[model samples]
Target: MSFAEEAWVPTTETECRIEGWSKETHQHGLQVRSSAEMNAQVVGILPAYVINFDSHNFGIEFQIIGSDRGWLKIRGAKDDPNRSKLPIRATYPGIGWIPGEQVAFMVQSGSGHQRPDAESAKLLDLKGDWLTSMGKIVRVVACSGEWVLLDYSLGRSRNPQTLALKRLTEAERRASQGRAWFRGVCAIQETSCETSWP
Candidate 1:
């Protein structure tokens, strides 16, 4: 079920710094499954070689691509069941998060408005090098049993909604200190994917 995969790594200096992912890190031979479909089987499991912990939110920025449904659920913790899960629909490319609240993104819903578990939402107090680290993640749940974790990092130009908003240009924005939001998981390859906000 697993589909194509990618990764974000150091690149030559350029006007715009971008990242690319490839299967060189891990083999997508395994079927990609959604959090709902895989049940207990997919306990936030990740492959090796994806290192360079960010110490921020604790986990690597794992981007899952192919999926049958348009929606995906981001849980607070990998193993925690039925916790706070965010919805990432096509309308919102990158979903923002409040430091403490675990903003999990999803594409669709079954019944009433889907709400993440209250306990799962909380600010991540990551003591790291990058002071300005924000993100909006887009992911997909595929029928192949493999999922897509797209980590779209945001500029560290202050909280757009707050006075911290620095109003820096794309260049200045990229210059500001930034860090990935992931710490690494032991039992499985814990990943912290992201997307950008409007």
Candidate 2:
């Protein structure tokens, strides 16, 4: 995406530090974009919001972008009973997945969001930010309270070693399925944050 202005919270901010976040250099490097490139494709007329949960501190950062789809707010941890206070939205980004293919979920935490403040967090400037996969997209569902789940199937024969759009054999699929699992991280807003990569 065209990062007009990069917003980062530094390696400080007890709740949003970026030191301990998972970092993976994408084998298929992403194509960076410019503002003009961003204008080329409409992320749609609407904007996408982010819901950040700090499991350690039990705080959440609910941020929204403006009409320009720019981030509007960040680091909202106040105790507000009004759910509307946290405006959250989801974007498909046209990331596809197949019916029977294995897929992975990657998340950026800690200093991941950078500016934890309201101003920096509201930048809805996602242009070319995407993850390319070998699967086809089936459907995406949104839940109440700002939760969006992407449902997709992974073919048992897709080879992870072959990054250039390839599949594996039945034996390879079985070996992969045997070790499949899910894990998460915890961020102590304004205190400490850590990530677990498997």
Quote the lDDT for 152 in model 2. 26
TM-score of each: 0.20, 0.18
**Candidate models: Cα lDDT each:** 0.25, 0.23
Local error of candidate 2 at 81, Å? 42
For candidate 1, the lDDT comes to 0.25
lDDT of 2 by residue, 64-165 (tens): 111112211122222222321444423222211111111122322111121333233333211222111222223211111121122223332333455333
Cα error of candidate 1 at position 116, Å: 23
Show where candidate 1 strays beyond 4 Å.
1-5, 8-133, 138-148, 157-168, 172-198
lDDT of 1 at 104: 31
What ranges in model 2 sit over 4 Å off? 1-132, 143-147, 155-165, 168-198
